[model samples]
Target: MDAIRIQTSAITRPSINLHTNPSGISFMKDKLLETDKSVFSVFGPNLGHYADDIIIVFKCEISPHPDANFSIQAATSFVSGNAFVLRPWLGKDPGSLDE
Candidate 1:
């Protein structure tokens, strides 16, 4: 699982890259394909006129085989907030609530 924090005002398209450690094998954004094998759901706060920042969360499975790293890059659109990847959280189960 990975959490990507995107704080930008402009609407843009994002791309992800996956890499394998030890072997130093990596898959570029264009090389890796997004298949329907996995489905992801994103949850975030509604942007308002007064809102200055937003947090976008991405959830995905990580192979237990070890040596796996991913990166995300977005196209130009609206420039404002910075983007970064958050470390995976440990312990405590997420709550289940559907609004």
Candidate 2:
């Protein structure tokens, strides 16, 4: 599971009345495509701002293929590409609330 926490304060410019820049807001769409071109080839209903934070959970069969795991790719890209602060956390399991 890959979890990313974006700091809203960092993305906003206080000088601009705390309103997010239109270009900066749109930057994620570009980055999403760049980061996961294979995953989001068409930019259909798969993408949206369903929540404040982005959490991608991948469930795949354990395979010998090295490329099967792209969690690192997603995490690294988000961290390296953005100037704003983003807290990304990677875990083997998305712990249950009951536990």
Candidate 3:
């Protein structure tokens, strides 16, 4: 079942890309598509694994705006992860992140 588990993990969890900036210093504020954890939670269950937790990369391939949130919506959607949870958060608060 290890293979199944690994495959599930690989399929469920979205792959994150980290790249360097022209300044040679990386910053996370980039590529944050979602700002809500609840979205990831729901995305987890459908992924065949309990939503133990979400990992927010402090730095992403793209740079974040000064007022951007940590969650990246594209990360979840593209990976078939969790972009739904972000819908509500986006409706109410555009840049809200828990912890």
**Residue 95 of model 2: what lDDT?**
40
lDDT score of model 1? 0.27
Model 3 deviation from native, Cα RMSD in Å: 13.5
lDDT of 2 by residue, 3-55 (tens): 22244554544436424432323445544444323332221233445313434
Candidate 2's TM-score reads 0.23
lDDT: which candidate is best?
A: 3
Candidate ranking (TM-score, best to worst): 2, 3, 1
Worst 10 residues of 1 by lDDT: 73-82
Q: Which segments of candidate 3 are over 4 A away from where they belong? A: 1-6, 9-50, 60-67, 70-99
With candidate 1 superimposed using the best TM-score fit, by how many Å does residue 33's alpha carbon deviate from the native? 5.1
How far residue 6's Cα lies from its native spot in candidate 3, in Å, is 7.1
Residue-wise lDDT of candidate 1 within 8-90, one digit each (tens)? Answer: 31223221222222111222321223322222222444333422344544345553335543333221000111222222232
Candidate lDDT values, in order: 0.27, 0.37, 0.39
Give per-model TM-scores.
Answer: 0.16, 0.23, 0.18
Model 3 Cα lDDT, one tens digit per residue, 1-99: 999999988865543221222211122422353223222323223443423356554456434566543444444343332444446554433333431
